[model samples]
Target: MSNSLQYIFGGPKAWDSGLWTASDDRVRGGSSISHLYTHPTQAKFYGHLDTKTLGGAGFASQRTVGDLALDLSCTEGIKLSLGWDSSDQTFTLNVKDTIPGKREDGRDEAGVSWEYDFKAPENGGEIFMKWDEFKATYRGREVEDPEPLKLNDIKRISLMARSFFDKQDGDFKLYVNWIAAVKKDDNDSDDDGDLKKHALEQRSDPRPVWKRLFCGLL
Candidate 1:
């Protein structure tokens, strides 16, 4: 039997009240925006990325809301079924284990985060991330030393379109079929067969696409 991957977001549930978008325009004094549009079989993340105002540093993103509390300690990492149009741009997947209480002034307290960078495939493909592939970051910069990722209490997962220090900018689109917690298949030779089966299952699913494009946090 193949190792089963559990859908944490996307997949049959699709995007609902559990997702939201945030952009650097919040703090950078820019006009860049990000949006998430959900379909029956996929979610599309598209937006304009403006780096000029921030001097080659700007970002827009979508993230899971509330405490997911996803216990992925037993699994390897994440597997994303995705498609994209921008080959030169890089995207980031971020995970956080802790959500600090609000400060005295009502601002959020910053916490450590684990991040992984990836380039989208041309037509669309599966991207697998191993647990160790994540790097720790604090206040947007990589840290030399930080506490290990707490998989058991993982609170958030996010997808970001970043300027990468002026390397990229402008409009971007990413199509996501699903995001799941995956374990490496012990039987690597059957990988192609498993993927074919997954495609067939997706085609057979009868869920209808909700007309609404965006869903805020519940």
Candidate 2:
């Protein structure tokens, strides 16, 4: 079967689907909140980041429901269509492959997470990320001894706006036109050339690092 880009979120289905919002307020006595508003053409993620309570560390995020699992091994990576209203504020796109079972105390176990940070352009554009671009992190810290990402068992995807340890705070908004898996094209020569150009461009203009320890990688 020929590989093709597949829509994971946005459009009509996302409009009716349930997305759970998670904020640091639950853990730190802050009042930050996040919301996902979906329309036929796009999804808007907007929220407030309260840094005062935790001494300049706060975050707001939204993620897919627990039952949603996507196998994207056939694709190269994800491509996001950003809308005009998308801000230049840094945002992290996180993916999880394993969902650990709950502990005896009813809290969820910790698992490795793959994360990539990007800044959306003011006029909006397509952001393409190859599989290798995602860095491994656990419990918000970069893992030196990282495990390979399980592409066939993607469990969750999240969009987050964080304070980045006092780097930024306050209200935030991001407009996403769609999120899709980018499949390799059949024309190898043409695809290779395009991918090479894209990789060079991405490397030339790198995004700011959100994880302090991973600054060297950026």
Candidate 3:
């Protein structure tokens, strides 16, 4: 429905539940569970997070069923359109440039992931996640000076609700309308330069565009 947008999900008809599967703490012997209920308008991600099962650490997530093999080189970043009635819980959006093979136990081998954590608006709205906003992480720990995300050949996507060091636990839900890659154009606002107050974007000798933006009045 957008001119400069390319949808990875949320198409013309009902969204497909077959494209996702729960990858929750249950696999790790924890009690948490999650599901993605698909519909024509949106998908609802609902789950119960039981941190006590694993000594106060738990996570619930729904991830793409298989490799996506998307080439997003042209887009500036990813965009998420949140449906109304979405919860205010912090959800992590993850992108993987590669998928590792499974161990003999059938558990996936841990690999680097690009993650962005955001709390959806109470009434739901659009959230843009610029490439610079994503952090390289491995098994939930930040990786310093890691190679930049392999944006061109993104292979997987996942949405997670996790106990942030016991900061959150219990029922959680998020309504997702669509997920797409967005391109900035002549008419677009360049607010991506606003200082997020996170680690500064990887610097280059010539200073990136964000170097010129001020964060005072936003």
Q: Between prediction 1 and prediction 3, which has the larger lDDT?
A: 3
For lDDT, the strongest prediction is 3
Q: In each prediction, how many residue pairs overlap at the backbone (N, C-alpha, C within less than 3 A)?
A: 0, 0, 0
Candidate 3, residue 180: lDDT:
78
CA RMSD of each candidate after superposition: 9.5, 11.3, 10.1
List candidate 1 stretches off by more than 4 Å: 84-88, 100-107, 184-218
Per-residue lDDT of model 1, residues 87-196, tens digit only: 45788899999876787775566667799999789878999998899999876789897888987567888888887778888998788888888744555424667656
Off by over 4 Å in 2: 1-4, 11-14, 23-25, 103-109, 187-218
Which pairs clash inside model 3? none
Q: List the residue pairs that clash in candidate 1.
A: none
Q: What is candidate 2's local distance difference test score? A: 0.72
Tens-digit lDDT string for candidate 2 (1-218): 45455677763335433555453454446667888887878888888887888787777888766744555655689988898877667998989988767878765567687998999888988898889999998766899968789775688888988877778888888999888887655542245566576546446643422211111112
Q: CA lDDT of each candidate?
A: 0.72, 0.72, 0.79
Alpha carbon lDDT at 151, candidate 1: 77
Give the Å error, residue 63, model 2.
Answer: 0.6
